[model samples]
Target: MNLIDTVRIALRALLKNKMRAALTILGVVIGIAAVTTIVSIGQGASRLVQGEFQTLGTNMILVLPGNTKRGGVRQGGAPTLTSVDADLIGQQCPEVLASSAVVWTQGQVIYGNENWNPKEMLGVGPDFLTVRNWQLEAGGFFCSSDIESNAKVCVIGHTLIPKLFQTTNPIGQLIRINNVPFRVIGILEKKGANMVGDDQDNVVLMPHTTVRKRINGSPLDNVHAIMVSARSTGKMNVATKQINSLMLERHEISPGDEPDFTVQDTTEIAEALGMITGTLTLMLSAIAGISLLVGGVGIMNIMLVSVTERTREIGIRMAIGARGKDILRQFLIESVVLSCIGGVIGLVLGTGASVGATVLINMYKPGTQWPIVVSIPAAIVAIAFAAAVGVFFGYYPARRASRLDPIDALRYE
Candidate 1:
């Protein structure tokens, strides 16, 4: 028989056992659907992480306190970094554009009769918001005079707006932090959350001088961290090294002594986090791949049963002039056709499921925007995998049918 004739006959046989054929195809459908859904979710998760990082800042480098060992035990926490260190790096490092020193604190903030406690009250320089890539939603950011005068002016995040001011306009309003009054100057634009689920919009900002001398009761020179903006993404490494060297010199650490502070390149932190998420996505895809393997086995089991049931039909076809290879070709075509039908249905189902998942996540989390995308390459590969499964499983049964004894099969009633 010609290839077309063989395929037609194979299709007819499958149509004759409609219920069995549908069952056989179900396995492939389930497997392919699982794979595509997994791949889509993994890709979406990667985009979400990247977006979260870029939301709060761009090209930011952090200077943090380093740990020191006492005898065999780790004791001292990060040495206090100061505004002086930030200024030196800004002046000496050609790769740096701007820098800000942060003094971190927390206390109850009261606006009129309303009292709300914020998680962080940041003491920062005027350049901190610029370095962080944060924009104002209302009013203007404090200027250089605000820092120099040790101004008790502040910027509040969006999430804290409702809690502190309610329906009233917060701009120009006076609020008290631990009874230390501050005039509301600007409202920070909304930034949802970080990877660790911490609220990025739940803090407040003030000059480092005000925070140190007034609220925290610490010396005006004390700071917890320094945020530096690199001239460009490409210059981040150079800026970090220069900052590190300048810090060592200012702290008077000798060549063999451990540094008092640590300089962290934000670009490196972002790259490392990306790698971790990518690995997690890969592992999830692999786990979903197990379903595809199981589906292939189902095809093999059903094919074996088909070979046994069609023994007499095969014998009659041979007696009537059909070649063994033609019988093999017919059965193989039937298996492949079933897999193809299943794969098409699976592609649609998987795409819909992925979209639904994205919507649900955004709806529940609120403010967390997630992407919904179907990978065309992954769908194409899944279909190709289904075809491969058909061939590998159908071959054994096809061979078995071709080897059957004509007289024995014909006499089997």
Candidate 2:
């Protein structure tokens, strides 16, 4: 028989037992669907994380308080960083473009009849806006004069507008932080959220001097952290080393001794998070792949059973002068057609599932930008792999049927 005839015969045989064929195909469908859904979701989550990091400035770096040890006892978060250190870093570190001393507190902010509690009330230097690469929606940032004179001026984030100001313009208006009145000089542009889902816009920024002397009553020299920006992306490592060396010398610490502060850059943090997400994606994909293996085994079992049930038919075909290789080809084609059908169905279901998952995530998070990304290459590969599975599993069964003795097979039936 010709190739066309063999395929037609194979299809007709499978159609004779539609229920059995469907049960076998369902196994492959489940396998392909699982793999596709997992890979698509994993890739989407990775993209979301990367986007969040990019939303924050890429060249930013943070100088935070490290652990301190005194008389063999370790203490968490020593108050060692200061405004002077921030200034020195800006002036001395060639790779550092700007630096800001930051102090923070949390309290109720009152404007007229409205009162709101923001996520952060920050005391930052004049260069804070430069270091963070933040922009003002209206008015302008505080200048050096404000820091020197300890001016009672502050900037508000976009989220605070609806909570406190209503329709009134926030700029040039008076708001009280912990009951201490300050004029709002600037309004920050909106930033939705960070990687960890913290609302970035629920904040208030004032000069470090004002926050130290007026609001919190902390020492003017002490600061909670120092924020800095590297001159360029390539200069981040050099800037970190320069800051570390300057801090060690300024603090009078030895070369091998542990310092009282730590330096961290956004580049390193982004890479670390990417690594974690990538590893998780790969691990989950592998777990999903197990289903594909199970499906292949199921195909083999069904094909072997088919060979036994069709033994008499195989004898009649051989008696009618059908070649062994022809018989094998027909069986192999039947198995491939079965798997390809399942693969197509699975691809459609998987794509739908990915989109549904994205919708569900957005519903829970509200403003999150979770995406549905179906890979075309992955879909094509899945279908091809399904075909390969059919060939591998059906070969033994087809060979057994092809090798049967014609006269003995016909007599047995």
lDDT at 37, model 2? 87
Instruction: Report the Cα lDDT for residue 179, model 2.
Output: 85
Best-fitting candidate, scored by TM-score: 2
lDDT of each: 0.84, 0.87
Error of 2 at 5 (Å): 5.8
Instruction: Score candidate 2 by lDDT.
Output: 0.87
In angstroms, give how far residue 389 of model 1 lies from its true place.
Answer: 1.5
Q: Write the per-residue lDDT of candidate 2 for residues 1-413, one digit (tens) a residue.
A: 99999989999999999998899888789888887888788788878877776666648889998888899788887798989999999999999999999998888999999999999899998888888778889998898899999999999999999999999998899998888989999999898876466889999999999898888787548899999899999999999999999999998888777889999988887778878877887787778777777877888889888888888888999988999999999889988988888888888898889889989987787667687799898899989988988898878888887888888778764
* Candidate no. 2 TM-score: 0.87
Error of 1 at 242 (Å): 2.9
What is the C-alpha lDDT profile of model 1 across 1-413, one tens digit per residue?
A: 89999988988988988998888888888878888888888878777777776764668899998876678577677455778888888889989999998888989989877888777789988888779899899998777788888899999998778997789999999999988999998999887766556788888999888899988887648689888999989998888888888888888888988887888886787678778877887787778767766777777788888888888999999999988898888888887888888888887888899999989987787666777878999999988988888888788888888888899989866
TM-score, one value per model? 0.86, 0.87
